[model samples]
Target chain A: MAAVALKNQLNAHIASMFAAGFLDKQFQELQILQDDGSSPGFVSEVVGLFIDDAEKITGLIAGLLDQPVVDFDKVDALVHQLKGSSASVGAQRVKLSCEQFHSYYEAKNRDGCVMALALLRNEFYDSRSKFQTMFQLEQQIEACS
Target chain B: MDRRRIRVLLVEDEEIHRVVARAVLRAAGVEVEEVENGAEAVRRVRESGAGGGSGAYNLIFTDKQMPVMDGHEATRQIRAMGVATPIVAVSSDSLPPDVQAFITAGANDFTPKPLTKEKLGHILAKFGLA
Candidate 1:
């Protein structure tokens, strides 16, 4: 019963993520990939990788932004990578934030870029927290099973 | 693994993307040979071609953007070598123009990033591997 409840919670959280536009069909594709006999932790493994990549890219973006003269091209490249990775995992909000960041990056608008970076940072953490919660529920269910 | 298993050459710089793609392809019983960038991909293809069938690969999947040679350039190079294997461009940029650019270069097909088993299967089937 505990496992069943945990499973329900996981499912509900995932459904809410989609409903909130925090995730999309691409995420469902990840789930389907996991359903095959590939690896039980396929989704978590990939998501963990995304988090790691995002962290490094986030650091790069910060460093670039802090430079005396901002290099919009450099920042744009990092954000582009982040956007793609986020989209792959179906992190819709983060992907959208990245798109905004790209627009500011292209215009070479420092203030706008800064604002966009903050929004992207916030969305990244928010999405990471929700993903962590979902993963925790999954682990609990797996442990009980 | 079967000696006669179908094989694919995957070129991706991102570790996570590589891991996910390898898992999906391997799960479907296909052999995967992974390389980090387009340059390495072209080299591998060249090596295989020179060896006269030792490195026979059924298909190739490359990321559009990378540190070294991008997918389009790599595709053009491989095509120039007379390597007839199907080349598929996998990128996060799902925009029509971006995808069309890769096709124009030499990619036989284009699939958006976060490749799934179903999408991989679709690509394989399109090439008659399925």
Candidate 2:
């Protein structure tokens, strides 16, 4: 099965974090932010919020492709949101690409966004799965230990 | 000069951020290597692994926003591939929760810009590299 083939990838990273003796402060806090209401599943709630934001931005960016010259200024706002949320999670390289994409938007240049998109897609695509796995693994590891 | 200085790999997309990080790290006695994007960062790591040197990258300081590969994905990719190089997230986003998330995402530590001595020192100390 697909799950069986993909051996847990975050084991070493999590182990290293424990070895370093640092708690996952940001994730814990983000959990608090999402759980301000103390809902049933706080962590999922926050990540879901982020996912919704990602969906809207993706749709917005996609819609721009149909325009005459692709008003980059309009797209820049979406890029900023993507950049901010990603950066909030310390997605540095993706944020940097978005920053560049935002600046280049003023010149009405589309190439920068394209390149930034490649990086952003790679960042989100990789992070969503890996982070989710890491979180679940962390929970399992905690339960076991 | 002495063994005190650390070798830092900086992968960033913005010119100003690169300059600022370089200055901050240099002031902290770190020798910085600059790369433009995530693609180059991965290539550099691979090259370093293929007998390029001791295959040691003391610190990898990256910006969250980049073009070819953003900081988070690059960090995730590097970790997923089993690179031991300690990565530190450097960006302008100062939200504490976000900083924590960066660490959770497998960054050795996190620092937001404009790089201050306190933050840089704290991060370096967290990794025991200061």
The most accurate candidate by lDDT is 1
User: Candidate 2: deviation at residue B39, Å?
Assistant: 1.5
Chain B of candidate 2 achieves a TM-score of: 0.82
Off by over 4 Å in 2: A1-145, B1-3, B50-54
Best-matching candidate per TM-score: 1
lDDT of 2 at B74: 79
Report per-candidate TM-score of chain A alone.
Answer: 0.96, 0.63
Candidate 2 lDDT over residue span A1-145, tens digit each: 3343233445565444435432234444443434443444544544454556666776788678556779776687677666655444434444556676665677676776666666666656555665576668656654554
TM-score of the second chain, each candidate in turn, equals 0.92, 0.82
Q: What's the distance in Å from true for residue B1, model 1?
A: 16
Q: Comparing only chain A of model 1 with the true chain A, what is the TM-score? A: 0.96
Best by DockQ: 1
The alpha-carbon deviation from the true structure for residue A1 of candidate 2, after best TM-score superposition, in angstroms, is: 83
A20-137 per-residue lDDT for model 1 (tens digits): 8899888887787788664588889889988998889988998888888998888977998998788778899999999878778888888888888889889999999999999899
